[model samples]
Target: MNKSTFNTASAIALAAAALAGPAVAQQATAVEEVIVTAQRSSQNLQQVPLAVTGYSGAFLERSKIEDFNDLRTRTPSLTFEQFAPGQPRYTIRGIGGGGGVAVFVDDVYMGQPSMSSVEFVDLERVEVLRGPQGTLFGRNATGGAIAFFTEKPGSDYRVKAKATVGNYDLKSVSALISGPVSDVLSAKISVIAREHSGYAFNETTGRDIEDETLAAARAALRFRPNDDWDIQLNIDGSTRRGTAPWWDLMIEAPKSAGKSNPEPRRGRNHTDDGYADIDNAGVSLNANWDSPIGTFTSITAFRNTQSHNRANTTGLLVAPLSDVANRRVNFHTLFIQQADQKAEQFSQELRLAADLGDRFKWIGGLYYYQDDGVANRLTDYRFYGFGPTPVDGRYAYASTNETKAFAAFMSGTFALTEQLKLQAGIRWSHDEKDHTTVASGKNFSGFRDGGVSVPGYSAASSADWSAWTPTASINYQVTPDVFVYGTISRGFKSGGFSDGDSEKQSILRPFNPEFVWNYETGARTEWFDRRLRVNATAFYMDYTDLQVSVFTQLAPNLPAVLVSGNAGKAKIKGFELEWNAVPIEGLNLYGNYTRTESEISALISGANNLAGKKIPRAPENKFFMGASLARDFGGMTATGRVDYTYQSDYFSSINNVPSERVLAQENWDAGLTMGPAGGAWSVEVWGKNLANELHVVSISDILGDAFANYAPPRTYGVTLSYRH
Candidate 1:
């Protein structure tokens, strides 16, 4: 069925079911409770003033959220775009891109967008906090924050394992084991591995693209020496090898054309080599002490990563450049390129929490972060000039980027009365970064001295930034089950390098930091004897110094350049509504809707004018609905669930080009489980994108053509899991 027909039918069915649900009540049972740590303390989700979503480990597995992309459809006011494995950019409420959002595991920030794309394992829960989180998370959280809480070792021994096989030679294995090792020590270990053949075929090489192979492991240990002291250590590593997203000539255009054109369902044609590999490792230590006055906690961590990528953009640049230059770009072609990158980081945090009598509660923390990174890129250029002399140039560049940051933060809540409360938070942060770039070009044309000549150049630049952000909120409780609150918060995002061939021309120039002031009001209420819940939030953001990437050609001989510039000012406003209901025992229903609108009011500086343009990737409207039912029959139990998602059209590029626009899409998924309650084994069958819709989720324009990356096709799989 078509999307419109399916949507109409589904809506009618859901409405009917909801209307008839309350009358058929089974054994009375309260809705499941959700706990979250969005405010740096454990609290019931309903008590939090911010717009947040929390999911337990069981929920994650049942929903088949194996990676970050899977999260895009499940959450409201959030979107994800992936250029490749380990390379993802997020847009939250029209405020994201260029590392604007932050992801953390146990309060330790991943530091980079690429590093945050790793697989999750043995997780206790996942929480997504919407809106600015600058008061506590600091820089890079101008949009929002996502936190992954890993499961800790328990005193009881436990083991869980699962394996799966699917089409396209897809294979996966995962296991987790936990137990007490000694009287005072407990440990947990988890590992996951996956391999899959590609889905797209490359006619040029007669091979499949988009294949993936990955493995990851984590080990954790906990020590409780006394009633007042607790310590925990965790170490993890991951390695992956995957073919990068291949650009195809989706829209067949003449070599003389430069503008991008839209073409749906284009065929794949990767004529050149393309690949990516990554290796990452990290270790963390946490300690806590319970004292009479409060609880003191410390966290320290170190991480490292090495990666390499090689791809060909011949059609996008070399071919067009050669055609425009009216020169013979050699048969071997001068377009293949490779980049190698390495990074190392260390961080430490100290925090204290106390309940000061019954009138006030406070939490404070100090944090430090340091990182060092190096990247090297090499390019081959070959084009024959007028005199049989080709510009066979071997160009190489290396860059080093380093950063150091420190911060202090504190938050408190005061009870003014039995029904009124006031909360405030403040943070002071300082950051500094140094960047150095060295570049050289060697022309092997054999016309100018038959030898390599290098006019070597190097440049360095540094920037220091500091910011003080504060947040305040007032919450009122109308009753024991209803809460209303309002808050205003400030956020900041650090800025850095651009894409260019030289330091003076691009990479070394620093852009100003972007900032946002967000105002939000929300309410949480429970109805029908706590069996139904409703939450809503409305927000507005005043954004300034928007960091935008601009493309230009400073000179004919120089390579095309992209620079980070403070280009425009924008305003964003949105509202979210979420509801959950357990009208009858063994049946649960949930749904959410979000509406966001953003506009660029003025263009202060930049290459192109973007006034009156909507921010890219920020869908105007989105909806999600799901239902799950479970029942017992004799000694066996059966459970089933279904979820549907719909998103309005949105642009994928900054220019708001028509060709970069994605049409509205609807996706549906369903699953079933059969087993005894609390049994050691269970069988599950699941299907995703049941309607088999085709839609582009991301696009790249560098290849002289609009190359689109489509969402996954319809997929179904079955699995059997065991636990002891």
Candidate 2:
């Protein structure tokens, strides 16, 4: 359907619901209340002055939100995409890039994007905080933050298991067991395994590509020696192996070098299959002590990850072949790239919180973090079809990076009167980064004299930066069922060097940090005797020193390299509306809408004049609506749910080229579940992307050729679950 028609329909549905809500409200029940920790403390969702979306574990399971990608579909003003397999990126409110948004699991920061694709297993809830979160988070959270809270070990013994079978030979199994080991000790364990057949056809191998196999497990131990202190330890690990999706060439290359494919879910490769393998593991220790003065908390964590990938740079099914010296050569076979990367991080955090009577409360913390990583890559552009030895045009590089950071933050709230409050926060952060690289190449094409040999060279660079971010807000309780708040906050992201390029100049040049100031006002209200809850927010951001990545050639004869640079300035304004209601018994409804506008106001000299261009991955309009109904029949309960989502068109790059635009898309999902009331067993039948819409998630322009990656297609499954 067209945009106009879809919007009109959405408006009508919303209006009808609003008109009918009060008439039936006398019989409706009160909506359930949700508690969140968006501000580092537990508070009612409706009372928190920030814009956050929360989903309970039960809701997630009912909606079949199995992964991070699925969660993004239900959150307003949030977008997720992958440039390549194992590389995940998130954008919120038109602000995103490397490290723009941060992810946390049980308060432990995740420093690597490769770990962002974790499965949702045994989670208590997931919270998505929109806008800047620099003061409390104190990291690279210029856009926002996503936090996952896992289920903790309980004193009672319990067991839960679930199994799923779906189309394309999909199979998944997950289990969780929790119990008390002793009077003062409790433990829990959770494990999951999933495998699925490929969705894209591979004609060359006569086998499907983009298949996946994954396994993950988590173990936890909690010790409560006495009422004054408690300690908890958690260990987790995961592994993934998958055939990477082959890029679809959207534009034909010159001289028939690469073939174009209009189909998004089809692949044709003349050479080896593209694939990715990733492994990640982490451990964390948390301790809490209650003192006469206040409460003290400490968190220590360590994580490590490794990944390897192989991809066909030129997605070509066929190419012109020629014979030189009685040897057959095909140029398409020469386009290949491989990379290996490893990273590890360690962090420590200490916090103290206290309540000064009932009028004032405060929290303060100190954080220290360190990380090290290395990456190796090889790119070949020579015909290897004739023999084992290639002619020329080969490049290889190894790069290493290290970082150490320290931060101190404090936040507090003071009640001025019975209905008015003031809140303020500040964070001071210091970061040091070091980078080194060794690169070498031979017989590069388009260089002087048709070829040039690059000797092995090493480069090193180091830099340090510091920033102070702060926030201030005022909240007023208009009534027992209404709240209004206004806030001004600043966010900062650290500066770093670019190591993707083989050139020394690009490796040594460090980009500046990015900063943004956000001004937002929001209102939360409940009507119809608490049966309906509606929250609305309007925000404007003054963004500066945006770090952008661009591929460019230093000189006419040099190869193009990816580099990080700072853009002049930009402006972003947006608004969001979220509502939840139970207009009648046995029925629940929820919906959200987001409207955003982002434009670059200035550009660096010598760069393309993109002052009025839209930011990449920032869609203008997004909407989601879902409904569920439950009924009792013959001592059993039956529940049915349906959801719909729409996303407007967006560009993949800052250049805003037509070929790089991702078209507007819509999706639908549904599920039906049945089980005995208060029973131990249940069954659910579910379907996702029921309409089988083909939408592009990412696009890249390489040497005048555009390649695109498509989202997953239709899938249906059945799940059986048991609890004790």
Candidate 3:
């Protein structure tokens, strides 16, 4: 993105959040403990022992989170980077997949980033599980896992709704309904719609807009014939439509200029006018049975998504750039292009455990999963102000890949003694990837000069691989509130064909899957009779054959896209602290902080001097703090909370480009919430980026020059939600 667009990233956010409303719908709290079975078992987040984070439906209405990116403010070690235009690659603990993060609903694995859908209304909670989850999850997830739990059928009839309007002509409305159908069955469903007139304008086709409209619904069916068997079925679906283009930088402006760039001739166009439309659907069944020996449970799921769009790659070429010191037009450049992608997949899980008396217990199961799809990219190019020339011309290129994968696994927990538990697991995965590329009628002039492109270009390649992973963990209860645990695990990612210099090695050389050997120990405890809760962990990940994306000026008209294969090692160690304090009744304080040291340990011997270099994009320090006060009146209950998140400086590029960095930035988001003292109805006026702090979330090639993706600026909105 260009500095022009990044400078205004906050304005775009303010305009967007106003129109987007909150992440989900609002309703009365249903479950007291907020149950989540993401690990294939029902467990409270506080009791799970593993590093976990969760947000309930109530939290959404109170905080006013409209998009997944808003989550970055609340969770530690969680990050998101845009993949193409609308899709986002979410990561946890600095361990996200190279291109995207694997997601699951209920128990079904989701593969398509473009069409994936998440709605907050009727949702149970959003769960983020840190570390490699190799033992139970279908595919070998090296980084971590995320799950969205929807509300299921219950015993009572309920109705909920929320409406909001604010900056940039934004409007949002949502509703949900649930009740008992018969003595043995019950159901619940939710619907939401959102709209905004955009905060950006296009220079070519002037329009003040970047609008999004999404409709989502989820239903749960519950049945019970007797006390012995309980079964529930769930279905979810949604479609999102808007002009969410890949807004690249058309101009690099100073931080002072903000989204208010001083450019007028671009015509009927705004930097964010890239257009797209999307749709998605998912279904699953969860059943539980109780017997004398123990309890057995099963979770099955499937999801499908289809997304399409025609994004104007024009921003890449027309972006205006200047030196860091002066806002002078540095160059007049232009290129036009776009890509189309689609993906879909399914998964299932079964868990059975037998309680062998009070002291002995164990559980194990078989897991299987398979995915087949194609990611096809079509690239088209053209020049500005004039027709095609000898040096500049219009062209199209096409590429496709078939991804198929399968895996099976088992794990169990054994009690060694009264206060200690032993956990072990193993898994084997087989993955096949087929890739092909074709470039025709495209003249390559710069390819002859740049060392990165192939001399006499041809378009395709393919490959495949199999992998195995093992893990062990031990938990010792030092006391009632303190526990010490350590785990060592391994995970791998499949290797595929690369179009660029990724082929530096011999063609006969096999593509080695990226591996992560992580070691860690942690503690979870509370002191002063639950007045303070502290969860801390220290971890190190040894990365090998790390898949790295390489960019080069292979084709001036193409903006160079390719990958490179190399063996490199790195160590990422970090400490995280989350705590709560209650010094007095009706008064509470909370704080969370993370400190990490991520660096390059080796860089292919003599190829690069990256050893000891700090990893790009990884911030060294991040902390969030908040305070809440509540006093019970005779007939009503009311409370107010305010929070702020602070992060240190971070690099934007792998090479540690200085000009492209998100410097020490501080963001403060606070909310004033008050309900009918009884907690049945409430209204909240919230301000995010309350200080109007201008900060960048990410920066990439937008036309060129420091293109940045920024956070939303200061804005205040009001929300009124009700439940009965």
Candidate 4:
């Protein structure tokens, strides 16, 4: 259905329920309480004014959610796409990019989107907050924020282990141990190892197009000298090596473009070498102190990460790029590329929370972060009869980025009456970034004329920016079981230098910050003796100075470069609904839906007139529903669950090219578990993508060729778990 229809349906459903609440009310078992920290404080989900979706560690395991990609179907208004392993793109209400969302592990921020896509093992809970969160989450949170809380050391000793064997030769083992070391100390450790021979079969190479090997470990130590203070230290590391799926040339090139139209095939590749490797490690320290006036918290962290990727640049083209005439060189021939990147980051945060009597509560914090990174790329066309010299089709590019940031934030809530409350928060942040780049190449690719006269070029640039965002919210309890709230908040995303182009495009300097003002209203209700819970939220956002990449050629007779700038304006609106019911004992049902509409109102002068184009990756309609049944059989217990998800079509690029869109698709997954009552072990059998549907999750159009990545096929697995 269209956006209007979807939105109307949502409104009618919510309004009807509110009007007929008493008629539908009945006696039943109450649902469990859901607690969240989306507001920087622990509160019942129903009492919070924000839109958040939370999944507990137990829920995650039962749902077979191994990573963020698998978590998408269980949540509303969330989607993921990728060009390669570890290079993930997430969209929320059509407002996502490099500077849209922020990810946090415990209190430590992961600076890059790719870094946040790691496996979600050993997590206590995962929370997703929708809308701009700049007032409290600092920079780069225009769309929203995702927070992952890891399991902490416990007061008692415990041991847990799990193993799984799945289709495509997939095998994994994970273990966790926790124990008390002394009177005042406790420690916990978790480790996981997994390997998968991917499902993508290559037609030309006779090999699997994608495969993975992964290992991760985390250890935590906690010290509690007394009731007034505590400290925790965490160390985590992970390594991944994989052969990423090869791209499919979907839409054929036009004959008028002087290129042959090759048929598209799934999991087929002509490239001989394509692989990715990544390593990440981090350390975090947290301390908490309680005083008569307030509670103080400090979080300090440092991280190191590195990655390498190798691929064929021309593998998707039908014919080699060359000239059979004058130079006897084919520019369309094989072009292999390699990229390497390494980064280091450090962050510190201090926060104080105070409870002034029972009517007033406040929180304030200060944060600082630093990042340094370098990336280098090399492209070679020697196999296409070209030498290693720049004039002979060899190219190299290198870039470095250094960033420093600081912020201060404060928030307070006041109970004006027994049923009404007022909340206000504001944050001020400053950011500085330095960028340097060097490029060396002959310029033999594609141009009406010979490449530039220079064999090498270099450029350096820097930028400093600051922003102040404020939030105001009002909430009122209509009844003991229902509440209504409204909020107006501003969010900001810090801009940085572009990395898509070489020094030849010096005009692609530093970009400016992007900002959004969000206005939202919502209602949370628990009816039928608390057996049914429903929450609905509607939001309107005004976005300005949006950072967008424009393809352009800085000089005549040269190829185009992707230069980013704050050059767009847009309007975004959406509605979300979440509902759960436990109408009968031993049975539970839960579902969520979202309707979103986004329009690009303006763009830069030289860019295409995309004023009416739909935002990329934002589907007009998304829905999910699931049911679980549990029962006792003598001395044993059995549980079964099934879920279905549906999403509308969406474009992958801001250009709104027809070839870069993914069609609507639906997916199904189910699981069954069995274990003896009071036993320490259980077994689960699960299947995902049961329908074996083939769909594209991402697509791109480059040089008149349409390339895309497909979602995984059907897979089934069995897992065994034991805990003590």
Choose the strongest candidate by lDDT: 2
- Badly placed stretches (over 4 Å) of model 3 are 1-38, 83-85, 138-140, 245-260, 263-272, 291-296, 312-331, 380-391, 394-397, 441-462, 498-511, 553-560, 564-567, 604-609, 632-637, 701-704
Alpha-carbon error at 222 in model 2, in Å? 0.9
Counting clashing residue pairs in each candidate, in order, gives 1, 0, 28, 10
Tell me the whole-model lDDT of each prediction, alpha carbons only. 0.75, 0.81, 0.61, 0.77
- Identify the leading candidate in terms of TM-score: 2
lDDT for model 2: 0.81
**Best-to-worst lDDT order:** 2, 4, 1, 3
Better of 1 and 3 by lDDT: 1
Model 2 spans > 4 angstroms off: 1-29, 253-257, 318-334, 382-392, 443-456, 553-560
Against the hidden reference, what TM-scores do the models get?
0.87, 0.91, 0.84, 0.89
Candidate 1 residue lDDT tens string, 1-724: 1234323332332232221111121332656678999998899998998889888887787777787767878888989986655567887896677878788987788886557856766888999888889887785798898889988887887676666667767766677778899989999878777777775656557677677777777889999988898899999987777766554434432442332223332233435547777888999998999999899999999999887777654323233323445453423223456778889999999999999999999999999999998889877655433234545677677889899999999999999998899999999988899988777776232111122333656768898889888999999998989999999999888877653343344555688888889999999999988899999999999888877764443434333344567755889999999888889887888888999999888764335678888887899999999988888787666778899999999988656766567779899999898776656666788888889887566764432345566666677788666666
lDDT of 1 at 623: 97
Q: Write the per-residue lDDT of candidate 2 for residues 139-190, one digit (tens) a residue.
A: 8899999999988897887676777889998877777777899999999888
Ranking by TM-score: 2, 4, 1, 3
TM-score of 3: 0.84
**lDDT tens string, model 3, 1-724?**
1223322322332332232222322222221234566446676555554666677765655556566766766777776666343466666666554532467665666766664456666665777777677666636466777777666667876676776666755565566667789988888766666655554456545665355665566778889767877898888777766664434453453432223235321233234355566677878888878877667777776766666665544344345445577644433334334455555555656667776766555566655454544444433443332223423544333445566666666666677887798877777777777655544444433332234554333444556677778888888888887877888887776665553231223222335677788788888777777677777888888888765553444444434443455448877889778777776676667778888778777764233465776666578898888776665567455567788888788766555545556688787777666665545566767777778775665665522445544444566677676666
Per-prediction CA RMSD (Å): 8.6, 8.7, 7.0, 9.6
- Write the number of the candidate with greater lDDT, choosing between 1 and 4: 4
